[model samples]
Target: MNLVLWIFTGLLATALLVSTVKAFLPREKIAATGPAAEWILDFSPGALRTIAGLEFLAAIGLILPAALDIAPILVPITATCVALLFVGATTVRLRRGERKTAVGDLVYLAIAIFIAIGRFGPWAFTS
Candidate 1:
């Protein structure tokens, strides 16, 4: 279970890092990408950047403490935050009638929630 959690954590963190980079692009550039990126137009550039910054932090938080075995409780806490962020993302997608994209957001949310539960429960590193 621990290994599985680590695998998922790494994958999620990598994905967030990629997303953070993309989010940092110019708003016009992001919005012009394609249908998958159309949602970028809904948010102000600053807000988009802020969201990206949080995701980057979350990615780091998910990995560093656990890997270092120092303040490892942060892994679950960060996972919770990631889940919350996905909840908001899913809400936005739904509100925009982007059901297809919303499903992807839900998948991320589920993964985050699973990590949070595992880390906070029997598979906890802090245990």
Candidate 2:
């Protein structure tokens, strides 16, 4: 279980950090962002950047607390928040007629939820 957590932490963190960096980069640097990223471009730059920043923070939240053994309860809370973010992402993707992207969001949402449940219950860390 610990190994699984570490895996998820690394994957999720890398993904989120990359996304955050991409969001801040110039439009030309992101010439081939997928349909979802293109859709995000439709919104204000601030909005897009905010989402990216939140994701980056959530990624850190997924790992830092548990890794440091300080306020480890935050792991579950962060996972729950990430799941909620993906729920919103899924909704937006569906609304944009992006079935594949929406499905991807659903997958992420599931993983985040799983982490939340596991960290909160069966795999909870001890003080």
Candidate 3:
């Protein structure tokens, strides 16, 4: 379970890092836009950068605590935050009638939830 959570965390963080970095770029700079970008484009660049910053923190938070063996409890806490982040993403997608993108957000939300639960419950690391 720990291994599974680690692998998922690594993948999730990497994917988020890429997407979040892209979010930091000016919308006009992007050659193309996806459904998710539709919602982001509705907001100001500052808003997009804010979301990107949160995502950057989340990506690092998901692994830093556990890897450093310091305040490892933050792993679950950060995972909870990631789950919340995806909930917002999914909600925005649904509001915009982007069902396909919403489905992807749901998958990410599920993975975040799983990591949170696993780390907090049976797979918890004890120092």
Candidate 4:
């Protein structure tokens, strides 16, 4: 279970880091800046960047609070927040008629919820 949590944490952290960097970068220079990127940037660059920053913060929240043994509750809180973010993303994708993207969001949402449940419920940290 610890291994699974670590793996998920690593994946989410890397993804959030990359996304936060990309959000800060100019749209034209963004590596994966495709139609989706343009769409998001067009709608509201500030909002997108805010969300990216939140994700980065959440990523850190998941690990730091528990690893340092200070405010371990932050781990589950972050997990829950990330899960909610994914849910919002899924809803946005669905509303935009992006079925494929919605499916991807569903997967992310599931992982985030799993982490929240594990961290806050049965698999909670003891130390």
Worst 10 residues of 1 by lDDT: 21-30
Return the TM-score for each candidate structure: 0.95, 0.88, 0.93, 0.87
Candidate 4 ranges with C-alpha deviation above 4 Å: 28-32
lDDT of 1 by residue, 82-122 (tens): 99999999988888889998988898999999999999999
Candidate 3 lDDT over 1-127, as tens digits, reads 7899999999889878987865657776652565456676667878888888888998999999999999999989999999999999888888889998788899999999999999999998789
- In order, the Cα lDDT scores of the candidates are 0.90, 0.80, 0.86, 0.78
Order by lDDT, highest first: 1, 3, 2, 4
Off by over 4 Å in 1: none
List candidate 2 segments past 4 Å from native: 27-36
The weakest ten consecutive residues by lDDT in model 2 span: 27-36
Q: Whose lDDT is higher: candidate 1's or candidate 2's?
A: 1
Error of 1 at 59 (Å): 0.4
lDDT by residue for model 2 (4-73), tens: 8768767766666777875667654464565556665556778877888898899889888988999999
Give the winner by lDDT: 1
RMSD of each: 1.1, 1.8, 1.5, 2.0
Q: Pick the candidate with the highest TM-score.
A: 1
